[model samples]
Target: MSLSSSVEFPARFSYACFRLTPHSVYAINATILPQKCRLSTILTAPSFDELFPDALVNPSRPSDLHSDPFWAPTLSVDLSDASGIWIHLGKAPAAQCDKLLINVYKEYSNDSSRVSFLETLEVKCPETAVKWENQRAGKYLLTAYVPIRGCKFLCDSADKHCRQCLRTHLSLEIRENRASFIWLALHTMKDHSYEIFIISAVLVGLIMLVMCMGMVYALWKQRRDAKRVQEIQLTMYVKAMLIYADDCVEHRNCMRMLVECLRHCATCEPVFDMEKLLQPDSVIPSRWLIDQIATLPKFIIVISECGSRILDTTESRTHHLVQARPFADLFGPAMEMIIRDATHNLIASKRKYCIVRLPYSPEVPANLAVLNFPVFNLPDQFGQLTAFLHDFENIDQLNISQPLSQSRMTSFREAVRLQMTFFEQNPDWLDTRWRPIDEPAIPQIREQRLPVEISTDEDRIAAAKLYGIDPPRADSEDEETGVGPSNERQFMLHPPANEPDSDTDDDDLSTSEDEIDDEDEEGGEMHTVVFRPDNLF
Candidate 1:
């Protein structure tokens, strides 16, 4: 039958029915015919129910009549060309097609009849022939029909064919033209999620960076403060060492270490050059010693008594070395003379010079007097030693002869006066002078000339005046006691014999008392008194 022909099928349609299995279904329905048709026409009609079934039919009623007016109306003109339609069915329904023929027609009158009906039967029963001929051909062909200009249908027994067909068509459409929209949606979601991730990552990184920077800065500041403290401590230690270098020659190691610390300190802070302190050619040691003493710092000289004795021996050697040099000329005359006298006294008396003692004691032995001048102490001694060094250092520039000519004599006399003054001020020193017993007395000598032959009164007067006495008198009370004007001047002015010679004896006793009084006034006591007589022949 031509696919486009509308046909009416007999209501007495019948066919061998097959049971529906779980995988298949069967559909049978009816529709009102709009035209008269013959049996041949029924045979020639396309499978209209398969091709165009109303989708509103109840799903539970596989065989119920579809009575809704919409279902009863003649199928509308085929819309296959305007909207493509597909149908699907499973196996079991095709074997029951003969009992389920349906009539499909259009609602139109003959007044406008331009259509013609023609019938011709052609059976494409290849599957039926193979089944009957072989009886073992298990594969079966379900019938399918399609109007030339209408929808397609399958006559298999599957009940979900329509849904399957619709699903397949939708899948095809999605695959063909909607792919870009789906991809765009997916990319947008990914972009949003990525943006959030990046923002979070950046925030976390910034926070960590800030924390790390803060930690680094704090550590740097701590180290800086520690370094500053160390520098201050080092500077103070060096200053202390410098001050102690005086009077503590054993602290040379401490001073050297302090200098080393100062060198290191200068690396981290502002300090003077420390290398100058250690220069071999410099007088830094001596200068530093002087400076240390000037600062009023004390050095502890820990001398055991035994050590003191050894030091004394060493000091003697040092003095001998000092004296053997010509540097004494650099000292003032007073100091020079005193040093010379002290040396002479030491040699003559075979006594140790107290000045040569190492570690001068505050009080010396009574026999060994300490010079009370400042120059006798260690500081002044060092000053003199340094002065000698200065002179030695500039020996070429000194004019020895010029100083001797201009000031040496005056300085020598002044030095004598100084010694006298020192002795006078300290009588204890003079009292210690050694004296000898049996000291020889001064002799009295007589004039060899004939006692000036005082034969005249002028001569007698001259002799009396020369001797610091009164002139002899003749016939005076002086002659009544057998006193004579003799050439001997002693008896000439003798006390009157009548006075019992008490004046002469008393005068001699008074002179001896005056001598003793004078000795007492000079701050010395005579251990023994000696008598001397002025005698006459």
Candidate 2:
């Protein structure tokens, strides 16, 4: 039999082994000697009923303690020639038996099973005794009953001391070879630690994944809303200027679709190409054609292959000018001159042309491609053309937007059919007999020397007389009556208060009052002038 129990040190130590014993002769003691086995504690001796509590034998009913694994006891013997028995207990702590008391029993009379009290011993165990170096795993034998050899004060009665020491040894080694409960608990905790770590890492990874997805979705939504707002604004600013074939035979399908698309726009106006109107049978004066070209704002021009061919035809060219007769009649030659000047200004600078190239024709002339005029190669669909004209600037310049609405497409097709019918019935309406021949090309003249350099005063007098204004004399008494010296001889002349200028009913001057002149005065101020018949001189 062996006495055993376990103690756990804090985590600083990897593993520790110890041997302990009681010092006094009157005390029972248990010691942990070094061994090669798992760490365990030794259990002290007790009656069979106390050791296996569930298997107690009753006189009325028999019980079997040998059948159960927990109640069974195995014994081993040591080959060493020692007089005392060897009690091996696994790595039990020495401190379990500290101040523990035990009683030894003896059998008497004829009943061998009966027992009586033999001796009572107090066990005095130390906190720590023998410490081992290695953590070797094997069994260990703890000789629980080691008798004290020398006793100074108690040795006066040698016989009494001998008997007491024998009795204490008997009490100490009553139990043998027990296991430690603490080692089992330590193994169980280590197993659960790995599972806990894995569970926590998985939870954290899932949370990060969800956050990333939400961030991406929010960014995508914000950009979508911004694009929608731009679409609405672009649609409102859309205006179309259509140039189509009048023949109604070639490209009739495309031409009708073009008209339908143009009608859907807030403003759809026809523009007559100057090249087309330079035909023999043309009735439109050059001035009428010029006025129509000058009043244009930001406009989209859709040209089909057939319409392009029509402009290059003599018959169609003549028809365009004749159709423009009504415009010339209403605005007259004066308005026509204003238009001619504006067109000439645009043609000279060639900076403000806004031309869009259709996907229908790649052979369109390079002359049509002017500065700052973007070219788009659109798809053949009408609805796509409408959407492209709406937001062409804000869209990706490389690709065309194809948001085809079926309803708009159907309506446009129907509108084109009606337009073709009107054109067929009114074929001769624009073909009036007022055909005018083209004017001769402007004659170039060599620069001639003037007999005398015209003085500033002479320029002022000439301009004043041309506008029928009697300019204030330089020797005038009132400074207000005379033109400022800085403004003298400028292209523009303000009417004098003393003499009312003749009213010139020219269309050129009618709309030119607000036109700012680029010519600067000597004082660096811009001269705001209306174009009168004198400016043409």
Candidate 3:
């Protein structure tokens, strides 16, 4: 009885039986291989001269199996020492095939060159699988059968027969069934080392592909996060404050132009929004300026004639804008406190402020004399401003370029009083004259009740009455509606000619009709003016 066993293996691992065991064989074959399979055999062990003497009966080893005429006429099967028969099949045949057979014989005796078979099992090609007991460590004779036309061709199973098994040529033809037969007797085993090497190469390739893909994704994510962080940094805004005078038309126009120019500075616009302060209808407060100065990076002040006058002037001050020289001096001690309170830290000049002065008026002082403060003029290339803005970080406590001059300083309350007086007299000038109607209204200057000892002119005195100040009633100035100081002689105060008598009433009529007539001839009105010695003295 003959047994035949044909098992499918991976094409890449063709003769690599040990490297790719039965477990890995199915996984690679089912997923990667095609329907067609290519097969090559390897033989090893005892030499064929001692095993099959029929093929070389004339004492000559045949190099080619097809050298025989009977092996021709059909497929030419090469029986080599290193490589045996090669087969290509489109699809596997059924498990049971009468034409293909395999015979397995277990060797029982330990012999030097000859042995006898004990147990035998006949396997029908691939259909009926033969299970041999003690297959772990044993010697066996296994022969494979293939169909050749209507005949059977026999070949030894590689690596199955060992030293204990007898090397013998067995040709079996049952019931004279042979039409034509080609038999490879006692085929030796062959170890195809190159096939095992090919399987290892494929596994390494798959691992490298997965690692490359992971590296690519990681690099892409790193770049994406870096780009997002850069964008956030570019668009962030830096705190800033703007200072300017709006006392005259040219000053206002220059400041408006500057504010618009700053708005057009695209890079700096993200860092500062000075445009809001210059908005026509914006009513910015005096404290708002201080607040911003206490908390922002850049402070821009337009140096002009109006600014110079206020800084120089000590006696009279504007209604809304306090003299900076005096205000700074008045709050010199509180400056550090105010700055510390606003920022919650000690003052850091570089981080807290970067002052820029624009000379709107050519008459600006040769030196603003502010220490550590730099003035930037309007450059021919406006783009430089945007570049300059990047130097300063956001902070509180910004000082304008112009420093407080050494002069007679007033208290904050006194400065406020002076501002109130000017605004009271010229309220419209503060609110309506400079800016457009649609713009934000200017902050109303808060009115302060000043001591009457500081007497204003008669016009201011009359304006004061509207603000609840009680003034002495006029006597002769009434009844005549349009009577005012004539162009002939200016109104003058004259001292009394004679001291009043102690017996006379204080309200007695002192002026005679003859003196009034003489004064009428002289083209001067006779007037009795009572002066307050408390104010004049």
Tell me, by TM-score, which candidate is best. 2
Q: Which scores higher on TM-score, 2 or 3?
A: 2
TM-score versus the correct structure, for each prediction: 0.15, 0.25, 0.24
lDDT values, one for every candidate? 0.31, 0.38, 0.37
Given candidate 2, what's the lDDT at residue 532? 32
In model 1, what is the error at residue 66, expressed in angstroms?
A: 16
User: Tens digits of per-residue lDDT for model 1 on 94-169?
Assistant: 2222211112112123332232222211223222111111111111112222122111234345654332111000
Model 2's alpha-carbon lDDT is 0.38
Candidate 3 regions with alpha-carbon error over 4 angstroms: 1-234, 269-284, 313-347, 350-367, 379-381, 392-537
Q: What root-mean-square deviation over C-alphas does model 1 reach?
A: 33.3
Error in Å for residue 181 of model 3: 99
lDDT of 2 by residue, 149-214 (tens): 332213456566432221122223323222244644555466676876787778888888888888
Q: Candidates 1 and 3: which is better by lDDT?
A: 3
Q: For residues 1-537, write the lDDT of model 3, one tens digit per residue.
A: 111234453255445453322111122222225746432232222233322234534446565755221111111111111222221111122112343333444444465244454544443434334333322123444444333333324335563432222221222112112121222111111234466568777878888888889899888976666455322232654434445554543334444454545554323442222344345665444454465555666555445434444343341233234322212221222233333443553244433433344422444443333334344554232333444355533212222221112231122223334444555666575334333324544455655565444444464345334432223333433324545443211122333553333333324322432465478789986554443322331
